[model samples]
Target: MRHILVHLDSGERTAVRLALATELATRFGARVTALFAQSDRYGPGIVARRAGPALEEAAAAAKAAAEAACAAAGVACEWWQLLHGERNHVVAETVICARYADLAVFGQYDPAGDAPVPEDLVEQVILNSGRPVLVVPAAGSYATVGRRALVAWNGSREAARALGDSMPFLAGADAVTVLSLRGAVESSVAGRVPPVDIAAHLASHGVTAEVDLVPPNEAGVTNMILNRGADLASDLLVMGAYGNYGFPFGLRGSNTRNILREMTMPVLFAH
Candidate 1:
């Protein structure tokens, strides 16, 4: 909500991440921290030594653009550089930076991009940061966000956390939908507390939400959630990043991974 931390790299979609961060900062009256993190392939070779300056220049350019965008939007901004030294891991460093913010913004993974960021950067941050993360899609332009929202609920602890973390957006949304997947719900408590409980909870926060009790889709839960978001024309999707035990939440869960891979709109995820 406030204290927005956005991850930026030399990737082409860095602007998209900054745009979303600025929009959220303007909406919530928050300060933006643009963290420029890219792996530095430092070594003793001449080519490796030359790559360092290029990376530094790229980081400087990203920082300047982030500051300029924030200034034009009348939002306070801070810049941070997380350098990946020979012994440092980019994912761990990024997660460390994300810990101090209320929400972290990131661009969806682009397999085609030449960005030096680790492929699992976003996933690691979400699992370790203990904060909500909003990921902007890498391919499209989202001029509007958090206006029309879709929340996927399965009554798990992760789902509850996601719902609570997304209260700010839901409370301000023009329309909100809570998609309760029946099969995913615990059978004992399935019929007892339906999506109405969630709707009522949102109502208490001034977020009027309509509930849809959907059965298990033959296709898959992930596809079902994405299809519902597209059908509802939602600008944001809120969901829990379910993970296996002995670790954090389920960023490794297929549902979470699939959704992140095929997401068409921004997704707000919590563990």
Candidate 2:
């Protein structure tokens, strides 16, 4: 993860987001881009009500805030990308851009995800970007240093991308475990390819992973994974997001959908 693209909407500016970004950027010598989308809420009538001056002031404030964060971090900064449109559209566009990004970090509302959303904000982006999306729940400092980790591996592109995105932290992982929870997600043919390919991939990346092929029909797979990570005192969880075909995503299995909605520690996900 040499470069990280940060979503600087209302969510990304939180202290939790800044702390996470700086921690990882400093850890792996990565560049951080605090990207704000200079968007109007919605509707042209709303724009006509108060658009230009209001937008300019908000944008200036956001840019200054992002620059100040970079200055504090002593990391290189690129605050030049301020996209505009509906909030959801800009986020969707950012996810598309994240495909080229090494990693994408951002803060989110709260545990319940009750934060007012325009619509389909997370699933659309995280599912399509093919990049790992890290969610910083609340305002608290987060870093990969001296942290244990739990990884969700299913031998899928989304999962693989997230695992690779986490290599920097995985290398620094005090303890790491890979959990393979296969449910109704795969077709019978998909079972043909063993999930061990993911373990091998992680091994190649120098991640010392302890693989666990949990038994099926095990209720609360997410809880089980979390329990295991908690047993090891892990602070981060890595997983590939699954979405139903509705999100224009290929892997929206129940597990992926459940994990994101019920996130515990910070989760790194790729769609």
What lDDT does each candidate get?
0.81, 0.65
Worst 10 residues of 1 by lDDT: 243-252
lDDT of 1 by residue, 3-113 (tens): 999888888899888888898899999999999887764531354423377777888899899989999999999998864433245677788999999999998888887
Off by over 4 Å in 2: 11-13, 38-52, 81-85, 109-119, 143-146, 182-201, 243-251
Which candidate wins on lDDT?
Answer: 1
TM-score of each: 0.89, 0.78
Q: Where does candidate 1 stray beyond 4 Å? A: 41-51, 85-88, 188-196, 216-219, 244-252
Please state the error at residue 228 of candidate 2 in Å.
2.6
For candidate 1, the per-residue lDDT at 222 reads 74
Tell me, what's the RMSD of every candidate?
Answer: 3.7, 4.6
Clashes of 1: 3
lDDT measured at residue 198 in model 2 versus the true structure, 0 to 100 = 56
In the range 141-248, model 2's lDDT, one tens digit per residue, is 565433778887655666666777778778887778888754434544565755545567767877777878765455666678778876877788887677342122
